[model samples]
Target: MPRFTVFMGLLAMTDDFVILVVDDNANNRFALRVLLSRLPETEVIEAAAGEEALMHTVTRDIHLILLDIQMPGMDGFETARHLLMTERTRNIPIIFLTAVFKAKEFIERGFAIGAVDYLTKPLEDNLLLSRVRFYQVLHARENRLADVVRQLRRQERSLSIALSQAEAANRTKSIFLANMSHELRTPLNAIIGFSEVVARSATIGPEDRKNLEIIYRSGNHLLALINEILDFSKIEAGRVEVVDEATDLGLLLDEVIKLLLPRAEQAGLTLLAQVETIPAVVRVDATKLRQVLLNLLGNAIKFTRQGSVVLEVRGDPATEGAVRIEFAVRDTGIGIALADQRRIFEPFTQIVTHAIGAGTGLGLAITQRYLSMMGAELTVESTLGEGSVFRFTLVAQLATEAVEVPASKGAVIGLAEADRGKRILIVDDDPDARRLLVQILAPLGFALAEAVDGMDAIARTASFCPQLILMDWRMPELDGLAAMQQIRAEQGEKAPPILMCTANVLGEQRSEAIAAGSSGFLVKPVRRDELFAALEEQLGLCFQRESTEQQKAAAVVISPTDLVAEIATLSDEIRDALRKAAEELNTSEVGALLARVADDHPHLARHIAAMLEEFQFEELIALLHA
Candidate 1:
């Protein structure tokens, strides 16, 4: 059909349409064909008799037909009669060619049988083509409309089918969610219940108690996974909310560090905290803030097996208004693949690696959503086998409308030990962890006492009259929050700084623990430095750092003459700068940190380039003289 339209369109321009010559006499047909050939782009088909002309009308494809009206078994009238009777050829325009008949009767008869006009013999070529082109345009337009109608019908059917398939897929997803929710929640409730029971029971034997600690840890881990999944669903559904309150930003970070250090240590990694110079308090949904930090840092620690995870704060310190503080956690673990970097932030997508364990894969997905809600964004920079730095920024409203204040010398790490002779109670369900924690705290000038559970802790609290109480939250007879509530009812305003310890150190949990009478909270496997800092800050005890003279008295001092030894322990910036100079290696096109390195450590200024190149001792000794 399209090809026929193209042919007609070509004919329309060239004045070529269909011209049929019909006659019983062969001479007449030949003469007619020769004359009509003068018309450009016209097609002439010859019929020797009326019968042949009728066949052309009924079967051949053409726009118009010319009929001869004399001398045959079927005359022009009979053929025209047949054309009109049949639906296939009825609409075709017919012009009668009659040389012998000028008879009015014959003309009228032709008109009665559906002939449009009669042309006598020796037809003019121009007159014949002009009539053919007229009908050709009419027929072409009809064919174009028919094609458009067919296309619209096909599109209508396809759209209906697609809509039906989409509806079916939605129904399947709904059903799956309903069934899986039950399967997940039932097992989670049991794990949390039994783990709490064992952790609270004082009668658990030492060997069995270790096993119980593992069980409780695993259960808490399970609970964390479930909570993450639920939170992700809410986020995907656009239902997560951030409830704001005036919060102590410094205290919040203290809890986050304590929670993450154990995981960092288990993987043999280092975790360090560097506080920003800004207002210590901020208005935020403390719960959401914590969740965002934990997710970013947890993923950093999970992927990083070595090196250090440093949490540094960056922000605008000039104004007490909405602050642009960033929490960046960096680690040197298995770095994310370049291709999977963007995909890792999407739900249910994990980097395809055998070493990285499986997850519900919503950590970063939820983290990004939470940060975005708080007018913040998360950014990452990483290289394959090199580690990643995940940082996010938030507008933290100041706790009070005041300009920045320098931390008091007492507020910042200077104080005297008034509780030097006081006893301290440490309650935890895990003995190794308890013993390890005691080892770190016992030497800080306190008589340390122990308790295996909350019941034991409460009993020891009364007898020991301890100045400090470090409590573990997930334990037996009572959980830490419940135990603290009971103890607070008795102690009233005298309640010491009761700290709660847990592994899942998300923001929501911390706020709940703090609201339930916890003066502070720490994450498990706490680092010694952080532990002491927490003890001194929360308990108001003094942590002694040896002075230069004190170190000399203890024989732990280094001589000032040892220039090489002194520079080796300096910053890597100085070391690299020194090494590059000694090796004569060109550094990056950007300016080096030479000036800053000199300002920070003046004694190592001359040796910066040598240290950067890792120059050998003898080479450095020789370079010093040269």
Candidate 2:
């Protein structure tokens, strides 16, 4: 009997296919081996008994097995049962070949015992070859498929390892950025804070006041740059969120123009603002909007050497209560090339031809992202060697309530009599930072204590029992979070309100500090007013502000005649040096020159100082010549 009849074309065989021949007589085994050898790359193993066949199946990688129905000790049927019982040789295909057991019941039993085919004593060679070839090709295909599966598993493992490494590297980069921001902002806290403190002194002459103003403004500019970098980092981390509030668009625009006017004047460029019409108050993210305008106007001033930079704003009614405001910043400078226009919006990208001044190249990129977050797109128009206009429109609902002009929190002279004796503990590792807090609070008549680090602050908290604590985030002895946790655990609800004043400006860092029981979070270079507001909130204290009359008296300007007379009193050499310093716009040199005049002619120096404070350089120069 034969199972496979149709003969396809002769197929090529691989060397991997191995066949086992099991029989009672050696002659039958030899005949099967000869027939299997006809196939290319096929290996045949001869087993005289079923026992030998089982041993071969275990030791060798057998693909196909030929079994005899009866043997002396272990027959083919019993051997097949044993093979099926073991896990190792269960999948090997078996064929039953028998001479005596050719009866119908015996054949049926052979087929039922897991034999792939039951052949009679007189075997057909062609049919046997076709069947053997079929199994050989099938086994070869299985082996190839198995090889592919193994290769795929190896590739998957490699990708998993690579992905893990990439994630680890990104984490490292984020940590490095956090540390860098903290380190940079810590010292800036003192720089900006101390400048403001000194500038507020009533006794300081107008010349000294002007110099301090420069220091304060420059510190703020540097702080803004630091913030820009941090903002980009936040954008990359997908943590930036827009915080909308009622904003006086007109007032904000005025303030931005005033801030950047000095730069434009220095560059001999005109800065103009044209507002056709706009809502008095609109709901929007004031901080981001201000930043966008600053970046655009600043870049315009930097690039244009002689021409004017214009900030034109137009508004139109959109929906029932919303206004679509189109703000455009146009400059007369070297414009961006058509090829580089789109590239300019990419982070840290600078056009070669338009790189006229110092910048991080992040201004426009940040501006674009900020606009995108506000549901707007920043578009640009430019002509090479002419100028460029960057414009964007935002739709904001009109805030119906009148924008309240907050009364100036004029120079905080001192705390009210009730809060004068309240105890305050300042905790920081940096001496300057502690000194800054002392400078701000000690003058207000608060009983202040200073601690070097978190551990020292915890000790002071018990001994001094301060009413309020200003804690720094990073310290040598113990980190702020861990130390704050310990204090909260020990003191529980009795703990004094602890404000975490740190240089870590990240939103997540602030969240962590608050989660650890911080009363409030303050990012540094903390403004004096901001620090005072935070204290007032925590301590429920009122501050004594400078009176209206005192503020007015401090702001009074010197008469032109008095200024001219003061300039005349200076020595010929001093007058020339003063004129030269004012002409060069060297603020420090002018301040030094004014000190010389203050020594002998105090009244005249004060008058000339007023002129310097107002940036009346041309007037001062003419008075010097007179």
Candidate 3:
């Protein structure tokens, strides 16, 4: 019996495949099973009649059915008719087992009922196995095709759902942006308007004047946060571009450091930059790369209160064709928890939310998107209390050949003395932003003027006869782009260097502005140095490099006594540090240092406990004297 079973299994393996044997004869069923078992993959299922075969075909995954022409109740012809009419089992291949011989009419009748092939009374075993194997292969292919069709249908449904969800999310985001614009601009207008009125007032006391300065600075910082959000949105939508060009990486790094150094200092934290190596020349999108570096360094300095925020660079040999540089910002501040590390990079996700106050929280998200576009990746390694290190590699196209040294020097061209009395028109709907620009330029001896809207700006231009017009995008009645176009139309080629002073720093917006007759762009809360530099460049000023010390000294210098008075006026963390330092010393140099510290790390508060241990009475007093 065991040997017989082994022989049957071997025969089954040789020609085994699924075959439905349907007949009223028990002998016929047994014979068909034995015959099919001789072939490989042959799994013969028995059905006593046509009705039983049709039922089995519907219930199980039978590939082929051989039906007897004459059964007791439901004959082969009627079963085939039923199977063909039903959708589920219509595609099952069928073969007819008949005693009838040579009538074309009977053959045509079987073909009409979906019989693919037929056989006579005495079955040929070789012919039977051969036909069964042929149908088996065809059936397997159909099964696979059916599965593929099902998968495609499922994928189509999934994509439809996803697309709908994305559209809804986009609508919500659009509404959120509109609401935020109004909420932010309203307070910003008052802060800017009141500060301007006080700053320019000749009758205001020095103390009152100092108070106004604080209001102006805070407002400006808040404005920067709002603008960052707008730019980030544009970037995520793929509307931002890298504008690839030869960039001065060192100068870019220095500027970013200069902007954030004051904040780091205010927190009693050192800001350290280490350039172990830098590519002498590499092609990059200077503006976008600056945004990336600024966001990374800014976050590092904001989080690191006591320890230094270190920026380190290294060369990557793999990216030899285009110089690959590795940049990392390491900080020992309140490091992100392991669980929150991934979330930290997401938009609007601030780890120490209360500590790092008043940001739109889009900086890191923008940086990530920017890096991705450049075919790079950013990763962070952190421990909850230890610190975090954010590192990314950038491949900037290397200059094919060496360029002139003068071009590489990043020299800042000073405006000729003629700029002093030149009339300027500032067109911005944001009153605070306009005020900031006026204050920065007015000191440089320009006859500054402003317009609240684009229409007013065009009207002001005719009489003002401004040498330069700093236009803001996203204004009511006429936006910066439309206004610039109108201005260019009226003035033709003589549209005096219309520069766009906008928070919409997205590349498309920049190109649109330039196409509309803007000579260049300056991103906002316009840095004083960049603002002047844009003016000089647009006004065709000759280039001149200033000594670093002279540049630092020339910046609006606030004395320690004056700064302490300013610090004494505030209610923030930095202000509290100054008050503590003031009680310890007779003078307010501690207040000045606090003021300086506030300039750098406005979000940080000095640990009074640490201060007690670090300073002696005279040592602390000397800081006040400085």
Give the candidates in order of lDDT, highest first. 2, 3, 1
Regions of candidate 3 where Cα sits further than 4 Å from its true position: 1-126, 129-137, 140-144, 171-205, 231-244, 316-319, 322-324, 331-343, 350-388, 395-397, 401-626
- Displacement of residue 92 (Cα, Å) in model 2 is 5.1
Count of clashes, each model: 25, 0, 17
Task: Give the winner by lDDT.
Answer: 2
Which model is ahead, 1 or 3, in terms of lDDT? 3
> In candidate 3, residue 191 scores what lDDT?
72
Tens-place lDDT per residue, model 1, 1-626, is 69878666544532346666667888877776786676555678788776777666544565677778886688888877887887887887888878774657888889988888887766677786566556666656766786787888788788878868866764564445434543554444345445544544578884476566666666666667767876786566454688888777787787898887655544445677887775677888989888888888887766664467788887687464667787788777668777788788888777755334546788888898888898888888888878888887787767674325433222122224666666678887767557655655555566789989888888888888877788877676787788788888988887677877655344456789888878777765353455667776786667556565554563321222344445556667656655555445443311255556566655454343333232232234322332
Better of 2 and 3 by lDDT: 2
Model number with the top TM-score: 2
In angstroms, the error of model 3 at 281 is 1.7
- Mind giving the per-residue lDDT tens digits that candidate 2 earns over 415-533? 77877889999999999999988988888899999999878988999899999999999999797777788888889889899999999888889999998899999998887778889
Question: What does the lDDT read for residue 130 in candidate 3?
Answer: 86
The 10-residue segment with the lowest total lDDT in model 1: 406-415
Candidate 2 residue 213 C-alpha distance from true site, Å? 2.9
TM-score of each: 0.39, 0.66, 0.59
